[model samples]
Target: MKRILILIMALVGLTVMMSGCSSQETVDVTADKIILVGTQNDYPPFAYADENNELTGYDIEVVKEIDKRLDGYTFEFVATPWDSMFLALESNKIQAIADQVAKTTEREERYLFTDESYFAAETVIVVKSGRTDIQTIEDLEGKNVGALAGDSYTLLLEEHNTKVDNDIILKYSESGNPAEILQDVQNGRVDAYVNDPIMINEVIGKLGLDLEVVGQALVNDDMGIVFKKDTQGEELKGLIDPILKQLKEDGTLVELSKKWTGGEYIPE
Candidate 1:
């Protein structure tokens, strides 16, 4: 009886040891889902918080489709401040940024980009609707220009037209997003604000804001996803490429853009 009891105890210990080992070795690559963060809540059509406070918009839908492609992986949405979105990525607080981060030489130095451009837009000066006096890009030369500090647009405004020797001093107002910039412009707090043309149109249409695009879109740019400044860049590249390609091929991107933006912001 002693021998039999000892044998049973030994078998139970073996089973427990094997079970623990198996559990430890279980690699859950799929369960290790990627986190996509954004700060364009007020930039609408790209990203924004609806009345319900849910993050919903063009960029939100695009990232959701990207999530669908990675069957094993899931996505968690976090609303990050615009200025801190990249910082969040750098700190690994978020795995990726799905905001309407435009491609820029300065940004390229610190980040990797996905090939797919959800939309092509240009920078434009937004002013109150009746302001015909500020009719062109030239009109903005000496005027106080407003843009979010530390944003891609600010860099574009600073570096693009260096030919002019300090023609306009960008009055970096530290607004949270483009909409706030427009609100300041309308309220006469700022002379003018710069932002994506599509976004300006969307905000005007949605809120019926008395804002108009005063000049032609400047600084042509492709909107895309951004990843950390690391060799693991290809991880996001590999995951999103196949999915975005499929979406483009099936006209899904256009459809989604329309659904979110009320029009084909991603023009055919």
Candidate 2:
């Protein structure tokens, strides 16, 4: 009887151990169901806070639509500053970025971009409303040009400046305040700035600023979601690319662009 009781106790212990292991496995699977996305809430018509302080914009809506189409995974957005977004992604704090991120050769080396671009816009030179002297990028010679410190547009401007023998004085701003930047231009603190034409127009309209874009497009850039260059990122790109392509084909992408920009901004 003693031996039988001992055997029964051993079996009970084994069962408990197995049950604990099973519970741990279930918990791991549950954790895998949540996907965190990062975005800057300061970019208007792309990812900005509404009057009620809810995040809503073209990029936010696009990600929401993607979440609806994909199954078995839930998305949670982490409002991160633009400058630190890539760092957060690289550290695995966020799975992807849904900001109006443009794909550039330098970024492509460090990150994986979505196969299908969700939006496109022309890069233009923005100056004070009455400024006719600085019309083209070439016209920025020896003038102070404002650019976000770590933005792709800044990189492009810097590259152009270097090509032109550093003719333009590059003024870097950490603050992502369009009003302040435009004010600087209006007050002669910065001679000009470079950004997407759509964004320039949006900011001017929203703030009642006296800024205007002058010159033909310097470059046309396609914007897409960005992910860290890793196995998980590759897998996510594979899953998202097909859905994005379908959305573009079915006119949903164009509709969203119109909803945000009041017209289709997708490249032809």
Candidate 3:
């Protein structure tokens, strides 16, 4: 009887040990995660610091909604300069960025962009008022084209130049000040500048500059969140893709777009 009782106690101990190991394994897989999201503080209505000194915008709120839906991941937004966001992401200092990042060949080579894009921006050639002669990119041969250096518009023109023998002078501004670039167009420093219609309207309307889009979209880019091209990036994308689709279906993204951008900016 004593030996039997001792054997039973030993079996119970073995069972408890096995149960503890199983629980630990479960915790390891389903443990809470803290994801660091990089955002810009100046891209108004998208990701900006408000007058109340709080970081709030369309992209900001979108990430927040994603966090609220996800089970274990907690997003901590780190607002930094536009350029610094990429530096931090490359260094692994941040896990993701929500600053209206668009997928380009250069960026896609180094980073991972989500399959679902939440926003769209169309780039077109903006010429001076009453300039109907300059319509498309082909018409801009022997003309100076102004765009922000290293941006999508510049990339578009660069690719176009490579494909054709045309001499489209690409004048780029490193400062990324749309006002200054647009002013250069008005002042005749450039024959035309490439920009989004929304931005062109905003700047030209405010500054009262006489500029107009060619009414032809040169590049329509669907913007998505960006991540490091690694296993972590892949897994995070897998997690986000489904939730993003749900947001679109449930009209949450539309509401957010309306709240911030004042229009339907989400891609159909």
Candidate 4:
């Protein structure tokens, strides 16, 4: 009888040790966990610095909301230039990007995009006020056009130029400055510029620039958070996708779009 009692006590102690080990492992995994999100601070109404120099914008707020819903995970924003944003992501400096990144075929092959899109935009041509002569892609022939280097707008212009037998003078801007591009158009340096219509309107209003959007929207794009194509990225996407769908269904995404763009830009 004494031997039986000793074996039972030994089993109880072994079970307690195993339980302690499992609890410690869980705690170690969750402790100090954080998600690094990248964004461009210059992109207003989407992601930008406010008067207090703190990062606050539509994208910034949306990420904050996600962080709140996710337990044991924190999101830290890393402001970067648009040109270098992808480089930073590829290097694992950031876990994801919340900038208004459009999902394109070429980019899809390299990165994993979230299943839910946070915003949508239409590309438009911007010219100096009173320049109604140039209104469409056909009018850009034999004219100087400017666009940010490595952007979809630049790709569209290049494709159009080729279709027209290279009649357009493409001025690729590497500075990533919307104001500089607008100034070039105002000074007659470039005949026109191309970018997202929502962004163009916000920049013109915020800076009080004398520019007007002309021509119909050239392309429609949906924007989503971007992640690296890897195991870690896949895990993060799995965690956020369901939450994003819930937000969309509950009308939170539409509310954010209206607050930032002054209209319901979220697609049905």
Candidate 5:
């Protein structure tokens, strides 16, 4: 009767209120509150811990810029190991990965690549300064080259390793991380180390290692932010592409590179 009708209407009102609150929560999920994932705190110049142990580096800076471009947003960082970084992104542990990920056709299939290329880089051969024996790319043939496992350098070496000849062994350093592989080269356990030129200089600057970019650079690469392969990234990609292009045009990226690596980082 009339009492029953009144109770039903009251219940409907409560339901409507709950729905409104849910919608408000959705509206709050704009870019400001987005989360990012990156490697462990020691990937210096890209992502690392500062003297105060706060997470800081180039990737953090560029992601902050991206947050600025996406009005009403903030950044939340998730520190993951290099091996687990991709999986963390895959599992939605973070909204995106701003860890200087390079675009590859294979990864493109598994992830959504931002049209924005935040930094341009290439692999380089590093050895002692006085090593005139390894002068060019060709000279790396039959030499003991080492790099971190699961790094982009490994992929590059895999491609070019065979080109040198099947006789030359593409030795993989048994180290768990990049620093160890670089150390192997410095300690004379390996003839050379192949890594990103920017990263090499940055690490060397930090450790005061006497190394030089010995051979010609390998594989030119464009590093981009990574997101899960989904419709959500589609809209974000459209918005971020132009912002990155503007950063490059205005030399913001070059400035960031110098701050991080103390080297010229202009896109070539």
Candidate 6:
């Protein structure tokens, strides 16, 4: 009876010790950061205003999910024109942009991109259906090619124009609405246009616009959230990068891609 009592006492003491040690364990607590995320309200299936005039799209929802996962970060989207996004970042009006932002040499110098990319943007030459005269960007030399101002596709067109003597005529809309550009193409206003294949496919099907992908991807680039090259940008990128990896691993990205874009647009 004495030996059994001693064993029971020892076990009770150990349990109490462990309970005290666990109670002393500190949790990682942090102040919440209000991240003013910049985005475009015109690009459909990515970020845009619905008929209700409320902002809701794939990129927007992704940020929302991130906000939920981030214990100390609150993401608030600030909508603006696609071209004006960088300006907002430069002016400190927004901390980062979560649009389907592709990288360029100039952008790399000016902004910091997340280590992981969320979207694989395959830019292709878009033309009217049943058109065999044009096959690639080079084939459109001396022809009118429509592209949004300040988009990566326009950058590619501009680069090609510099290499060749006969530059492709570039038509642009201040609105940068893909449907308007597609209608322009259908009405014979412009010979061709260039944009992301998934976005082009989405807009074409929704509006019943008569356009087709002319060739394989002119350029394949991964889209990352962009921020001004500064301390806050660096810190925010660090916080978001791991969560982005988690989302990809957990198949959240595939779900969002299929839901909004109607297919898997994520990078393999």
| Local distance difference test scores for all models | 0.76, 0.85, 0.84, 0.85, 0.75, 0.86
Q: lDDT score, residue 214, model 5?
A: 74
Q: Sort by TM-score, best first: what order?
A: 2, 4, 6, 1, 5, 3
Quote model 2's TM-score. 0.86
Cα displacement (Å) at residue 103, model 5: 2.1
In terms of lDDT, which candidate is strongest?
A: 6
Candidate 5 residue-wise lDDT, 15-128, digit = tens: 999999999999887645455555567677788889998889888887777677777556678877777788787777876877767788878888888776887778788887
lDDT of 6 by residue, 40-80 (tens): 88788899889998888999988888898988788888988
**Minimal lDDT window, size 10, model 4:** 159-168
TM-score of every candidate: 0.84, 0.86, 0.76, 0.86, 0.78, 0.85
Give the local distance difference test score of model 3.
Answer: 0.84
lDDT of 1 by residue, 185-225 (tens): 87887788888777888877766788888766767777888
Task: Give the winner by TM-score.
Answer: 2
Candidate 4, residues 1-268, lDDT tens digits: the string is 9999999999999999999999999877756478899998887888888898888888898898888888878999998888888999999999999988888888899999998887878888899999879998888888998877667778788778777774778887778876678778878899998887777788888778889999899898888889999998998898888887887889988899888888887755
Clash counts per candidate, in order, are 0, 0, 0, 0, 2, 0
Provide the global lDDT of candidate 1 against the true structure: 0.76
Better-scoring candidate (lDDT), 3 or 4: 4
lDDT of 2 by residue, 1-268 (tens): 9999999999999999999999999877844367899987777878888899888899999999998998877788888888789999999999999988888998998899997999997788888888779887778878899878667778888888768775788887767665567778877889898887777788788888788899898888898899989898998999999989888989999999999988887754
Model 3 spans > 4 angstroms off: 1-34, 79-84
Find the number of clashing residue pairs for candidate 5: 2
lDDT for predicted candidate 5 compared with the true structure: 0.75
Over the stretch 1-268, how does candidate 3's per-residue lDDT look in tens digits? Answer: 9999999999999999999999999878866789999987755657767788789878899999999889889999888765477889988889999987778978989889989998888888898999988988899888998876556777788888888887789887765566678999999999998766776776687679998888678778998989998899999999998899889999999999888667887898
Say which prediction, candidate 4 or candidate 5, comes out ahead on lDDT: 4
